[model samples]
Target: MRILIVHNLLWAHYKSSVFQALQHLVDQQADLSVQVLQIARNERSRAGLETSGGETPPTYTYNYELLFDRYLEETSVRERTRLLLQRARAYRPDVINLTGYYDPAQLLLLIWAKINGIKVVMQNESTAADQQRGGWKERFKRWIFSQCDGFFCFGSQAAKYVIQLGVPPAKVLLRKNAVDNNALRAVYERALPTRIQQQQALGLKPNNFVFVGRLIEAKNLPMLLTSFAEATKRSKNGDTWGIILLGEGDEQTKLIQTIHTLGLTEHVILLPGRPWFRVPEILALSNVLVLPSRSEPWGLVVNEAMACGLPVIVSERCGCAVDLVHHGQNGFVFDPDQATQLTQQLMQFMDSAVDMEQMGKAAKQFIAPYAPEVVAQEMLNGFIKITN
Candidate 1:
């Protein structure tokens, strides 16, 4: 089997699942050749083009920015179409996989593939309701869906959304984002050693709640800060509970200001965003993980936290909350936008450290089956069913 993956970039620190999936396919060694073609807005500098290993799969690049921003008015839609057609002819891919937000390139390639009797599959996170906002973009997306042989969605909600867009239910597949359980097991095994070093370095105590992910409106950081502040105030053991906010984004300055206004300087600690490799170290240092997002299609970090044997408090809106969390059994799920609910959930974990630990252990067991390799195999099975 030969597969071509079309995405926004070849490598991104946050998109580890994609890398794991592609790597799993290559590791199958079933006479499979996987090529990754990235359509990016920025050109990679000399320093940015280094490969991790010699046998990495996937190769192709089409700079959308070069066609739009660099050339100004020179490149036309017809020229863009011609370029993509040329690439399709050269690669002659058995199957083309599309990822990320919709792009003109995806539409063009899918249309061309349909005409050439080639298989095309689109994987995206957008819900059906999101496409109902009447506009040229919605119409364009509908047209794109018409050209694809199958659709891969992040969860059942997204699969339902895609089916609502006129694709047959049989053609829509649900594949959740997964954690690298092998890596997670290694991290958990070394947790004690890493935690000792992390505590020594950061001056963090044994009991602290950690929040990871981008600081943004969609993440509902303001509500989280407020809820944590309230939880600390209402706690019987004052100063016993500590909150660590990790990752950086557009909401950082505003969230910092809000933290100060609420007099939560001592209770909340802000850490700069670290690379993916260092996340396990951070997760190991904390007792509980919280993801308060207003609208999370799926919270991959929650799975990672659970895999590392930490209790998680995720928003009800998160897709992973539906499958991963069994309230009071593994972890808790609260209304992300509601300060009181969020505060109550956090207090539940903080009030009893022993119960939290037991739940954390349960969390690890809950998500053990949905490992990256297992998820990748499911994805391959889905692709084969759709193509056949």
Candidate 2:
């Protein structure tokens, strides 16, 4: 079987990890082969996440062609459609896997593949709560979904969203997304011995709740600050804990002002953004990962933290919250609207009643099933099922 996968950004390290594992699988099976067409080098918003060498990270192990070595926004739809069609025709794949349906260029390719009797699979990450949905856009999504032969969704919420848009339940081929678990754990473990020294050098507290993402409005940073302040005030041992915001964004100035207003200047620390590979260093110094996003498709940082053996506190709106978080066991999930609930959960973490080490072990165990090799195998199985 020949599979052609179309992806948007070549700089996406997480997807590259899965593709690498998929290529390893293909190498072992004489009948199976895979190729990828990367639409662009990276997205404009993610340009800062590039390696210091200003080159793609040395993580790719799969066969892929980078069609445009520029930001995604710089490429016009006509150029993308023309090149994608030309490549698809040349490759003549038995099955085509598309990243998502939002891109008009990819959607055009999907229609072409269907016309040519090639099986098509869509990898989806959006959930019902991702954004407001209704009107002609919904109808268009339904039509596009109807053309797909199979799906590989990020998690349960994503799978349900596709099914709600008129896809048959059986067509939901794979229901997981993954990161490089072994690599993340290795990095975290390597940094473990020096974690205290690193934290002291940065003037960070002994125990910290770390938030690892862009500092944008959607992340609800101001709300997180308010909740963290309240949690600290309510917990007697909260003085030993602190909150670390580890990413750069437009809200930095405002978040700093909010920290001052909340009288948490001493308890809150803001760090500059780091590359994807270096995130485990910060995770090594943190006790828990907190993602209080008002809107999140899937919080991959949660997966990274879990792989590093740290429990997470995620909001219900995040797509991974349902599948990754086990409330009161590994971590807790709360409604973003309920600031008091988040405060309570934070205080619970700092209190002596909760066994953080045990919770961390549970988190590691819970996230093991979402490893890159496992997801790649499942994706190959989905292809076999659909093409058969």
Candidate 3:
């Protein structure tokens, strides 16, 4: 069996880990092979994450080709379609896994693969709650999904969204996402002893709830700030706890102003974004991970924090929330729009009633099955199912 995965970005360190696992799995199997087609070096929005200038390079164990050694935004649809089709024809894959349904170039490639009797497995990351569904767009998505042989969704919400779009439940082959679990755990373990020193050096509180992602409006940063302040007022030991907002985006200025207005300048700390690999360093100092995005397809940072044995507080809208978070156990999931609910959850963590260490252990256990190696095996099983 020959499999070709069409992925969008080379700068995706997490996806690289999964591909590495897939390549390892294929190596042990007879007559099985896997290759990847990376569309571009990175996207314009993710240029800061590129490890081109002396940073440690990511591990690339899979056989692959880079379609364009530049940002994807610079590539035109016609050129992408031409090159993608040209490459697919040359690779002669038995099965192809496309990244998503919205890309015109990939959709054309999907049509060509179906016409040639090659199996098509689509990877879906979008959920029904993440965005507004509509007239022609949903119809177009249904038509595209109908042409797929199988689907590898990011989580239960994503799978449900596809089934709602007219795809049979049996066609949903895999329902998980992954990150470099082993690597993240190793980093966190190594940094554990130095956690106090590092937090002191950065002038951070002893206990903190860390939010890792772009500081955009969709992240509901303003609401998070308000909830944090309210939680502080409700807690008896609020002086020992703080909230860290890590990552940079267009909403930084507004968030800073809101912090000052809420009289949370001392309690709310804003840190610039770091590459995904270095995120565990920040996680070492945090007691809990918080992602309050009003609309998140799949919050991968939640996975990273869980791998580091930190409980998460995720929004109910996140695709990963349903599968990963067990409310009152590993973490709590609350409506992003409800300030009171988030505040109460935060206050619970700030108080001594909840055992965060026990919850963190539960989080690590919950995220174990979503590791790269496990997810890679599940993906391979999906391929075998459709191919046989």
Clashes of 3: 0
Deviation of model 1 at 270, angstroms = 0.8
lDDT of 1 by residue, 14-91 (tens): 344545565667666876666655444323331222332343423322221222332213445576566666766777
Cα miss at 347, model 3 (Å)?
0.6
**In model 2, how large is the Cα lDDT of residue 138?**
91
Candidate 3 lDDT over 227-254, as tens digits, reads 9898888899898998899899999999
After superposition, candidate 1 runs with Cα above 4 Å error: 13-32, 40-84, 128-136, 194-197
lDDT of 1: 0.70
Clashing pairs in 3: none
TM-score of 1: 0.82
lDDT of 3 at 279: 84
Q: Best by lDDT, which number?
A: 2
Local error of candidate 3 at residue 295 (angstroms): 0.3
lDDT for 344 in candidate 3 is 92
Ranking by lDDT: 2, 3, 1
**Which 10-residue span in candidate 3 carries the lowest summed lDDT?**
49-58
